[model samples]
Target: MIDFLPMTREDMVERGWDQLDFLFISGDAYVDHPSFGPAIICRLLEKYGHKVGIIAQPDWRSTSDFKQLGKPRLGVLVSAGNLDSMLNKYTAAKKYRSTDNYSPGGQAGLRPERATLVYCNRIREVWKDVPLIIGGIEASLRRFAHYDYWSDSVRRSILIDSRADLLIYGMGEKQIKDLSTQLSTGMCIRNIRDIPGTCYRTESLEHLWDYIEIPSYQNVAKNKQEFANAFKIQYLEQDPIRGKTIVQNHGEQYVVQNPPAMPLTTGEMDEIYDLPYQRTYHPVYEAAGGVPAIQEVKFSIVSHRGCYGSCSFCALYAHQGRIIQSRSKESILREAGQLVKLPDFKGYIHDVGGPTANFRQPACEQQANRGTCRGKQCLFPSACKNLNTNHSEYLELLRAVRQIPGIKKVFVRSGLRYDYLLAAGDREFLRELCEHHVSGQLKVAPEHVSQKVTQLMGKAGKETYLKFKKAYEQTNRDLGKEQYLVPYFMSSHPGAGLKEAVELAEFLRDTGYHPEQVQDFIPTPGSLSTCMYYTGINPLTNEKVYVAKTPHDKQLQRALLQYRNPKNYDLVYEALIKTGRRDLIGYEQHCLIRPPQTKQLSSRQPRPEKTDKPGKQRRLTPTRNKTAKKQAR
Candidate 1:
């Protein structure tokens, strides 16, 4: 009864169940860890007294593997693993990736491309009529019509294409419990369409009330302007309290997305994380090199959920929402105590943070009751007047965890919003962070230095990051700690042209920090930045913005970030010339590059008068010549 949920028919029979209530199909191998969505959901369902089975990474070429676990009594739950299948199989450049960390042995090509659609289709072929519910990152992000980066075209909701009966978006613990509870009572999936945090297709809108209708999918698909217009409406309605249900016409039927579910209270979050997860991949995978994804998160603890950072390119706001929900300090400490008891527990606790590490409370007290303001962010344009900027609770939580015996250090590896930290006005937190949490280096995301580009990215001004940097350095100096700050940067973001790219390079040079890892803006589905990338206009304002789409241009922008690398010299030189910044290519100390050495110039005599002029040479004579020769030698 304590083992992993039935993966084989024999295991199901051993559990004395003739049929399961839900059969969970996932693109990832079975890892009964809380970090994996499928595991958390399945464990929660089992905790609620429903029987469940898992069919992980089933063969998609045929239905034979899909039918191995037999049909569920109520429904079939489908997911494309923990990550979007498209992102898992392809890089940002749209090239096929060779390995999948979610699979055993870190194998490649275990699941087909677009795993959610393929898995749902396979389930349909097997059952012919079972309720197919798709939930996961892939289904969550694509629950509405959005641009598909791989195909460079607009795609309709995954609910429409996959033919699934229901799509649960966001962190679907609450929604899934409601779904399973209703299914247990014999209510059909179609009739359970009123659940918040869920989406379904309907032919009639008679029962739906208080819903706003977005532009039809056909219209958005045809008109870029209409797509941007529709997206703005969707973005505004993500709040749980004030958000209205959204309906979009797709031909004869409609895709109806209910309002977001309320975030879990502290007690509810504690219960979910405190579940009896095995905390590792299934033992069956030990011979296959175990799950590689768990290695990073196995020792870490997720103390909070959701983020208020609201970076335009990030899908967290759209997927996890802007609400900040956290686990109780007791719950977090209890988990830490358990972590220290594990055989693999090192003195170091790898990380202790969530989407944005320092955000331990709601953006404002009213957010939990009134919901986040539509079309306005808590920390964008400028920090909202109502924003709550404090890190006292978070700082105390970190201190409490580290005080537990057997734990040496706890780092905050997840993103630390520098702007928010600056807004908090707590020098104590900065001092503690530099003194303890930093492991020789701390990573902060400034994204870019240009104001125009940062605005488009939904980040604060460069001055905020600069302020944090000064404070952090001062804290380290006060403590006599020899730690450094590693800032993360991006390239090829919307509204970032050659000019902005060069500006970022100059900023990096001034800071004397060259980032080893750089991210080219990937226009993933279900993000405001993706809307801008596809439409070439700011979706929120309809203002035209520059975008770097071509591979050459994107590479040049990326190269500019690491212009010191010899391998990037060609791309950096090309970017400088193209941006009319040829002055940055000289031998000056501030230059991004030294002028390229030419075959004709490498062997030329050292005469002061010889310039690029084709056939002219002037020489100095007498005492001037002797001084010149001595200088040259």
Candidate 2:
């Protein structure tokens, strides 16, 4: 009993013949996106009668839309680091290559039918033998054996390059309902690799754990990679999990790991934001008769979930758990009364909240480990009370989602830590959470304005975003109204060098917020700002701080924190007059110049080994108005 979705296309043409059924496929491109983790596995497989279909955001170059959503059906759910790979060439031929299709929103392009896992291997070359299975967060952070900031390369083991027959990974509806009751009482998919959040396809390295009851590998022989380093591993192709050798019993340590991931239930997240959605846009022009209502509006809820603000370039405190966990203000006013009965129902509500919806519990209510923070900031010097700083129950869950019904405005539009709500004194519940969940602009990250780069980037204190930008501008001029606060800014993190990215581009040019879209740090894989951007000194602050950790010094300190044109000032004055960094050459062509890039080195010629062969990876381009120096003729 665990699914709750599939609105029409004939409710998947009447259970499209249950045979070998279970097709969830989400590679996370936020499809018609409702998610309480895909509506409790599509309403618990139609409440136990079994027959599901939710291929959301999957145009993995058509396997006839997974053969019209059913048939010879049984396995294929994929998550664990959910899809994004098509090396360069924006939408090469196109099927799915978006990561905000290259704007200032975190790079990810490749789609010459390169949709996640090459559009699931062209739908397994036309369903050759079915059973794909991958699981979310881009297949649980690339499933194992990592290091690949857009092909900086170490790769292997996303169950061996998406040739996936299995790999369920964390927080999936109890191992996708026990692999659909062991493939409906028959179980192929290789005798279902001992189920549980499965990882499958065995033989030479067999070992399965029947779901870890502890002790299979000869009892903790030197704590198996420190107990496989806190189970946050991710891979879709990096391998090495098979027999990296360890087999013990009796004190318990069979140690191969990869199973225990359940998590979900606020009534399956209010039946996934109260199901029945219709948010479209060019869904072939709302199937003719038009109603694109600027991308078929409405439907975007989440009242809350994990995130106690671990934020050292977040992985959501090791994948969702810093604990804020909400939902209940009449279950978010019954999902805003089913998102105002669609028909592109945009009376506006885009966000309900989570991660920072004014954190409600855990910076103090005890969930200890209190270890690991090797510097990407937060050496913890404020915001205490168990770090779950309150929001007076998110201001009564945003005043019962602004008294629902035909809702015309509920917007909290996520993110507003502003130094843990001024260390949880709650400044009158952050001024009634921005005069009742702001809309005309509120975003807020203040990622860095320098208090030693906001404590090396864990955040809070740079005068706590100017005391919540002066009590959110005197409560929007004492409610005469007119919002605006936006402010996110991140520029070259990991103890931001180049003198703290030019004192954070002169503190976003004295707060007028110019060229302000800046993030450029990308450490990724379970970030602590990728261990201070691969070791520049923060092994627990033996502090030698200074890291722009290369990519041409993180694109010249994120182009001088969003520097303005003048041909990015002759490529930041020939890469800062060849790294002598001549004080950012009078702040380059002004209007907040960038200046860094001057290399002409030929010290009489001998350059070759720039990087080739082995895992073969140069890839990542996206530099746009290239500072040119071309050579591969």
Candidate 3:
């Protein structure tokens, strides 16, 4: 019978199982959605005929709560929910968040500060000898020695801290399954260290055949340059086929990381998604209010996994890898068809994409055979020469989904790789996107407009975004649609000084697009940008780069994005003066903000003329044109 995994002892008995083979512990409340990692791993184990039970958000203060489901015969699996615990509970400024959408009733502080380590520690206290395996975004990203933004120190690999017998680094499907099978067959955890996409602690390298040893934990911690060098080596070895066995020394022992798992074939993705998932939180949480994280994804579909658009600020490369694995059209359609039958079906599919919405296949044909090139990116600094930029397959998939009987709309809310879209020879996809998928607004991340900053971000330069902007506007005009491109921007990233922040302010002013919300650069672990933030040097080139670390400097950079807001007037003024662009503070027609004033300023800021109307170009009065000509002379 298809049912939710056993969450309690009664549940275990209800399943007619004497004991579970695995007891999966997580920080977030039990959610069976595919987007949830614990759910996917547990369900995959169940599919393999192993009985699994879930212990969601157990009390970390004591081990009593962990005893609810009882111990497992094979091992105990742990994860820090969907997000990193520290990242989920705190902000970039090191402030606690009051709400956690992943929790039941959307409550905060249900889980401890460092969830992965806490959960693993608690599991050890209860069942000392059971195999402890940790996976998920938190564990995956922290699989190696890296910088911790919150603590402001170089921490050892999570494998060493959590004391998990085995750490599955990437998407864990292949690794966990293989590891579980071995454990069930009576193989010890220490003997199963050679599995790809996993990490383990070893006393000596004698057991390892071929491996690349990174700088020891002490060395990376003592010297910033060594830290950067170690990060560079780890970054280069993430590919599934080309990646090597990366090892790092912790004091007396070593932590060894196996190469990433290969991307799942389309049939594999189909089988995983087709599992018997309840697609909602356990009924016990219904009174407290179900999980708030399911709202956006309940009716949506994950079209693919992995991203080639390797934004430096993102952790997809560290967690999902760079390979793009898409589900077949039949599988996506099947999921859409199922969504239509849901009691709350609203005739709208919230999204139909993954890491990148439009990316359906590998960036090039050779990636499947040779794996992605470790050093070179497919679409950064400019699209690579070997990149195969195409959108026909994705366009066709959208068309097929739209034709499903009860589906009224299919929106691509996931971030779209605008540079990749622009590079494609087919404008038909753009036309189709503008015509159907968009629901009055399409959001894309431009991050920054300055070439230096964008390059540091590992994103395409502003020229590419501008080209895409022009094309998007033209497409909207041709389709007679009034949709708006709500571009997302980030501030205070490494390499973004006052100069770069002011450049972004000017772009916002010139475009007449005032973002209601702007993201400040957050240095999450396992990203190249985080390396720069911690070391003040680009690991790729070993060149010194400016990072805005002070609270005041970060505030100024953020204000520059919203320069028109009166609340940010002082910060914006300070940034303008600091950048030596004080001329923009006046009351001129093109000025970003007016000079300081005691009285309250109007909330409505002057916008670019062309932006006020659809399909209209900015026009200057004859007198104003003459004034401009005289000024030029």
Q: What is the TM-score of each candidate against the true structure?
A: 0.94, 0.31, 0.95
What number of clashing residue pairs does each candidate have, in the order they appear? Answer: 0, 76, 0
Candidates by TM-score, descending order: 3, 1, 2
The C-alpha stretches of model 1 lying farther than 4 A from their native spots are 598-633
TM-score of 1: 0.94
lDDT of 2 by residue, 411-472 (tens): 77677677766666666776666676776678777777777767766677667778778777
Across 267-326, the per-residue lDDT of candidate 1 in tens digits comes to 999999999888889888899999899998898999898998889998988778889889
Cα deviation in Å at residue 399, candidate 2?
A: 9.9
Better of 2 and 3 by TM-score: 3
Model 1 scores worst on lDDT over the 10 consecutive residues at: 606-615
RMSD of each: 6.7, 24.6, 4.1
lDDT for model 2, on a 0 to 1 scale?
Answer: 0.52
In order, what lDDT does every prediction score? 0.87, 0.52, 0.87
**Lowest-sum lDDT 10-residue window in model 3:** 598-607
Candidate 2 is scored at a TM of: 0.31
